[model samples]
Target: MQLKKLILLVTVLAGSYTLMAQTDKNSIDDKQNESQKKIKKSKTQLKDAEANFLLNYYEQDGDHSPVTGGRGTEKLENVAPTFVVHIPLDTVSNLDLNFGIDFYTSASTNNIDYFEGRKTGASGKDVRSHINAAYSRDLRNSGNAYSLMAGFSAEFDVTSFNFGGSYTINSKDKNRSLSLDALYMNDSWKLLYPYERRSDGTNWLKDDKRTTMKFGLSYSQVINKRLQALFSAEVVSQTGLLSTPFHRVFFDDVNGIPYDNLRSFSHVEMLDDNRLKIPVSMRLNYYLNDFMRLRTFYRFYTDSWGITAHTASIELPIQITPSLIASPFFRYHTQTSADYFYEFGQVSKAMVDAKETQFYTSDYDLSDLSSTKIGLGLQYSPLLGVGRFKSPFVKNKQVQFKSIGLRTAFYDRSDGLNAWLVSLDFAFTF
Candidate 1:
């Protein structure tokens, strides 16, 4: 009986040790699993942080442009250089602050040495400057975005203030980029006119003042991974002083010297009616490949002056190789004459006498005014390195360096005025 009892106790002791060993192995397995999970989480976090850092450092968007001639609604035919800069906000939130300024010199754009015109008063060519700043922000809802912009060209003669916002709605896929935006622009149009009067006949002392408010809306759709289409429309409403005072006009009733009729003066008329205009535009962009692309657009315009026109333009960018490219563009425009447009010395004898001339007259009212523009230029972005700022920032391998656009236009007016307007643009990035 004592021997049997000893054997039973030994068996119990071995069973207890085996149970203990199994428990210890289970504990060790749990610890190893925890360590592995921690390592994987750390690696994922490191990768995410590295990507974010890269996105913030090297991302860049910039534009440098020099444009000369091409007239529309009192636009200058002179050449001007403009630079634009965009800096990232570097926050998780989609936000950015964009600021830039313009340096305008009359010497490079104008060919005149000096003229004592009634506008300049023999003061030689005047110089003008402009500055702009703005802030942009993203909305809490992934569909909305907005920005505010205000700037001044010259306090004395030029300044503008504007605010705008944009949004997209109810999209199935968040990866697809599609959105629409609307903006309002309010402005005073008295800038760039010289108020000084001197020996030169040109003077702005007796001019009518006008202010305009405009509304615009745009829609963009991503056709695919490589293509997009844009549509936009804008309307402008203008009121206030519409005519010039110093302008000369001779009435039919006043064959001789009249009490108010003026001689050799401006041709602007004073009218109680306000003005309204609408401009509609459409654009299509298609990427044939990574190195080739095509951009095309059509615009239609009309105003209160009883003028209407259509414009069509296209740009073809061909990649010669990886580092070099050539782009050619063409545009066509056709429009009717304004309601008040007239020929030289053409005035109504029945209207009230005024101090202004019947100078608003353009012989073109007898027919139609049409214009065409064609240009070709080369682009080079050689010896480039991959930008760490984004996954693919150095796209277009040849980035636009220098481009020259040459164009000529034709007009059919009663004054028999026909000429060609030439324009050129050059750009670079630093």
Candidate 2:
């Protein structure tokens, strides 16, 4: 009887152990299924993608053409079209692509090949295209974001490639933020000289490479519900050819006789190849009411070439209706001339003869000047889609128009330069 009791006790203990093992296994399976469901839900919450298109037309007319020793028509026209797309990779990452093309015609550029000593400016046209791609990701619930970008630009005589990255950190409350960015660019140029400076077949510029580096830091804060502000500072360094090859600089001889009939014959521009630049800026936005806002900006800039500049701008935006907004803006900018800048007929005969002046530029662009720009813009964005179109190649795929904007600006410079620009922008989503 004692032996039977012992066998029964062993069987009961073994059965209890097996049942506990099965329960633990089932618990693990349930935990894994719940974790997978959470992950799927997070992925499905990704945001929708968007796209934008912009077109601009600009025209300018002035009498100071640098290529002609700063004494001819500076007429130019430009048309630029740009496209941008934003795509969400997942719940915490996104990708952006941007492409743009600019077609321009400049009367000043035509002066590089002045015709038979004639004063008539040449008509020069060229095209420039650029593309940029970027990827950005948000840290896992940390309110930190990081981005990397690469870009390339190409033109008839110039090509440049750039790479950059930025990081942003936000406060726990999300009302304050800081950002840092760095960029590097490599540029190659095909040197083309003024008609008079080029010997029968010899090139003027032997070295045509340039490199640039930039660093930036910024901070943004919200002081109150109606006021927000941001501050930014940047440093830029550049090395190699900074002067335009075709810009003509005329000099007077001891006899006061201008070289080459003061028309076609002259020396090209020369300047320091290395430069450093620093700029600091601030922006403030004030929300006056549900329908009105004010934006203001100011910047201070200084450079190694002895140039100092200041810029100030203000804009007021008013919501005319639920679907319409109007904004008017004004900007003022002033800058001191570079140490080497010389206006037309301003260079002395002694300086020309000594040839000791290490730096000299007859380019008016480097001269002291003040400018003002006034602009007006209108934007239309309805709560409901304004229009939609189905893609012929993709079934059940449609694109909707979200908003449209138009802007026009008039620019005037103290140095007799003036311009007008009009731009149109459209936003869409799929």
lDDT of 2 at 358: 64
RMSD of 1: 26.1
After superposition, candidate 1 runs with Cα above 4 Å error: 1-79, 92-124, 140-143, 155-159, 167-209, 225-227, 242-268, 271-273, 351-367, 383-430
Name the lDDT of candidate 2. Answer: 0.70
Q: Each model's TM-score, in the order given?
A: 0.57, 0.86
Model 2 lDDT per residue over 41-109, tens place: 455587657787878787778887777777778788778787878888998888888788778878877
Question: Number of clashing pairs, model 1?
Answer: 22
lDDT of 1 at 354: 62
- Measured with C-alpha atoms, the lDDT of residue 46 in candidate 2 is 72
Span of ten consecutive residues with least summed lDDT in model 2: 25-34
lDDT of 1 by residue, 1-430 (tens): 1111111111111001100100010010000000001124442232121110000000101110010001111112222233334443533122222223222222212311112223231112333344444555545556555555444343223334444444444344543444444434333444232112222555433433445555666677787877888877777666654433222222343345432223233233333347677878899988888667888888888877777877787877777755566667676667886666543334564342463433243223212566555555454434332222222445543332322222222222222223233323232222
Quantify all predictions' global Cα lDDT against the true fold. Answer: 0.38, 0.70
Q: In TM-score terms, which candidate is top?
A: 2
